[model samples]
Target: MAVYTKRDFSVNLKSHGGILILALIAVFHLWIQVTGLQYTTAAKTGWIIGMTPVFMALLGLAVFKESLTLIKTSGILVAFFGLILLISHGDLSSIDLISNKGDFLILGSSFTWAVYSIVNKKISLNYPPMMTILFLFLMMGIIISPFTINDASIQSVIHLTFKGWIAILFLGILCSGAAYVMWAQALKEMESTKVGAFLYFEPFVTVIAARIVLNERITLLMILAGIIITLGVVLVNVNLKKIVLYKKSKKDM
Candidate 1:
């Protein structure tokens, strides 16, 4: 996530709210991994996770008095359509899209993340962002401890390799804990949509990460999809005046 600051531009969002965010994310990841192993298809999982922002935006408007601008709403819709395209492509009849328990877990994860985002906006006004994050993580750590593996024979129940262990740990520490804190701190300073816009990048990042990790081929369709998504992101964030000026400059050239 990118940082936005009105006053102190050098403030570190990561140092403040990242850990708590990460803990919540870690829980989500754990749940998804467990559920996905027993399930198939990615549609249900995506729909569950994907619905959160709309929910969160509603929460913000209802509870926090944050207005949803038309432009912002359009951006959200465009991003979602892009996500659908990227995830489903042209497969309209794939039952695999609706077959996973991971879908419910992902939905739950989004709900928790929504709670975190709303609470963060409220509490950041009263407390240090980092302190709030620290306490949240501590609370999560306690809550999640019960789910941790305690028995030896249970290993056979959920088979995991060394790489999987590493993945889980990294997800917890870096993506969950650290990224959450960074994002929270950024939320304190930036407009919500500005911070939220970074999520559009996540699909791209995942594709790239997957390609690197899985040796997946990057096809022409994927490249075109990326270009369309990039254009959508620009439309969502770029200033209209700047866009006009750029067009004029191109015409002059």
Candidate 2:
């Protein structure tokens, strides 16, 4: 990204304090997410994550002055309810099981992610997505290095199994790097509110991955909740122009 920026001084990248702040935010977000998994099931975490779009919408409205419509607002509610139902397995009492604190940690990660998305979206308006995300990755790497160094050694890297190397490369390059770049670009191209609706797909994807990789059972209730979650996201993404036209058509009667 710096290569394409055409800046006379490479040091200019350091001038973007927002990227530095974004890196620090990423650290806490990553830490809680990884550490919290020890205490809670991934299924519960993904369900909690389904609320991310609502947080994004709220932050967009409050910080960025993004507007909310009746249609989008209702869509957010429906999707969130569907998400809760999915997470709780249709029993609202299941929420009380979150008292274990891991769920709260997951909740914290969600808020951090919302802040990260909104901030990244705001910064992308000024800096190119590649530059911002690359810088963010570099800074986060520096911040995370010390904490991880004790767990990793030069010998471990040198002697890593081919499969282990593949997994590391996939996570570092594709999942963390490329995925974030695309997400930042999407936020740049669309409203944060709309960009966030895509997060509703995470749990479904996670479920599918679990079923295939871990041989987890996929139940009828899961199918029902997945459909409802998908419908809610579709509702949120529906164009306001079409909604107005539909309403107007009804009013003509």
Candidate 3:
């Protein structure tokens, strides 16, 4: 990104501090997510990870003093309900986080992601979006090198198949790199709650991908839940005033 932009990689001390903080949060968020997945089922993990929007809303309210309007609250509740329905497959009783140690870890990860989003919104405008992300990636890499550079890890990477290497590249370059840069840019222009609400689509997308890639069956219930999730996301992001004005203008015309 830096090379492509041709902009010098220089920042003030304050910007450097922001990048460091974001990097630390990213490291913790990634670590917790990976660790949590080991202790819980994918369904449970998805459901918990879906709570990120709620955490983002609450944290925005508490920390950033961002307004929590009625529409936003309703959308969050609606989306959260859809998430529960999707994950539980209509059996709410099966969704249990109390018994799983990993659930807490995943929950922590969700909260940390909220923190990252909120903090990034405040700090990201200080630099070019890609530059900020690049600096953050570098900082996180430095922080994580000690833990990941050992002989066992090196040998594991060496032993990975072509498919494994491809997966790693996809995750590193597209998922973490490109996706985060876009996310930061979104934060620059949108409210944290609105941006976070889009995360509700993660599991919905996962289900669709699984259907296509893994040839998994998609039930009617899943379709309904996906529609509900989409509606909720739209509800959270739609501007009621603009809609009302548009309607009035059309009537006048």
Candidate 4:
């Protein structure tokens, strides 16, 4: 691409091959999310997806030998509880009321996403983040196109309204393309475990977006759920030793 498109590069084919493997894992994560959504409620899916950070923290320890401190572990557990609150809408009974194949699939997707993040971080150590993401987007687009490329879809694209086309362009360009590139860049700079905490906020973001776009009401439970989720994420990122020492000192008082 650098040769024909007038771009610059020093990366070799072997390096690109490594990026491609990482991209494929990312593609698999995306595929799983889509497939899982079909079998579950969006709320359930979002809740399950929120578990990715926890899974990423664990995978970072298991796969990359990343540091797993007491604080980080506690943070993960706290984040998890917060996730439960968000998912269950603060009703303990609601969790048991909702369990199905889709929930399981979403869990699988979370696992895969963690894997993808850890692997991407590993690979980014060698390659440029932007270039790697570009390659990933290109490859994933090619792989995914076949699934959507049918006679009915072909006809539908031509009939899409101006607003629909704009939305598609925005998603393809800003969300999928730019957002992915930025995420890749972020993963390159941070520990995958630390980065995973960001997933906890996703449901909250979804809720806010829903309120604006879908005109959904934000109840007290939703606000509490958001607070718990944020607290959990904060705990996951907080220094465990500091927290312990602080508690001990206050007890001495």
Which of the numbered candidates is closest to the native, going by highest TM-score?
Answer: 3
lDDT of 2 by residue, 111-163 (tens): 89999999998788878787788778889989888877774576788889999
| Candidate 1 structure quality by residue, lDDT tens digits, 137-190 | 676777687777578647744798888889888987797668867876887897
Residues 71-170 of candidate 3: C-alpha lDDT, one tens digit per residue: 8778778877876686667898876775556867887998899899988998877777778898899999999999999999989998999999999999
What is the number of residue pairs that collide in model 2? Answer: 0
lDDT score, residue 1, model 2? Answer: 42
Query: Poorest 10 consecutive residues of model 4 by lDDT?
Result: 1-10
Residue 191 in model 1: lDDT = 58
TM for every model, in the order presented, reads 0.61, 0.79, 0.82, 0.77
Candidate 3: Cα lDDT at 67:
74
lDDT of 1: 0.58
Give per-residue CA lDDT, model 4, range 1-253, as digits (tens): 3234554566557667777777678778777777778776565455567667777767877988867777667777776776666556667687652455566667788888788788788778777777777677777777778888999999999999999999999988787777877788899888776677777678767766767776666667656655655565566566567679999999999
lDDT of each: 0.58, 0.78, 0.80, 0.72
Q: How close is candidate 3 to the true structure, as a TM-score?
A: 0.82
Q: What value does the lDDT take at residue 252 in candidate 3?
A: 100
What value does the lDDT take at residue 42 in candidate 1? 37
